[model samples]
Target: MPMPAQEIEELIRAGIPDAQVEITDLAGDGDHYSARVVAESFRGLPRVRQHQLVYEALGGRMGGALHALQLTTACPTEE
Candidate 1:
């Protein structure tokens, strides 16, 4: 059971509140995805930690419903 892109985006937004996320299914299978997330919450966190936070938002679905995620996280840029 692959995770839906909307579900993954919802989870990330739930955790970060103000995340701007773009999701793509890399394998044409919902199980493999690529996500680019920009959030204010990432301002102080390391990239690894930011990724972990997003993974945690998935609630243990990483190895099961969600197979692989190529993620890019960043703090919102100053305008």
Candidate 2:
């Protein structure tokens, strides 16, 4: 089964409590998604590590239940 956007958002939020997550259905088919996550926890992490954290949040569903996800991450900019 394809993972729902809400589930994806919930997983990310669970992994990073302080994250601001936005999930978009790129292909309109529910299997492909784009997620933009912003969090203070990502502040010092490299982009690759940041993506890894999000992947961990998915709990090994990347190629199974969750087919494809285009993920982007960033730390909150200081005002």
lDDT of 2 by residue, 1-79 (tens): 8889999999999998999999999999999999999999998889999999999998998999899999999999999
Best by lDDT: 2
Best by TM-score: 2
**Model 2 CA lDDT for position 46:** 97
TM-scores of the models, in the order given: 0.92, 0.97
State, as a TM-score between 0 and 1, how close model 1 is to the true structure. 0.92
Give residue 35's error in model 1 in angstroms. Answer: 0.6
Candidate 2: regions farther than 4 A off: none
Which 10-residue window in model 2 sums to the lowest lDDT? 57-66
Every model: Cα RMSD to truth: 0.9, 0.5
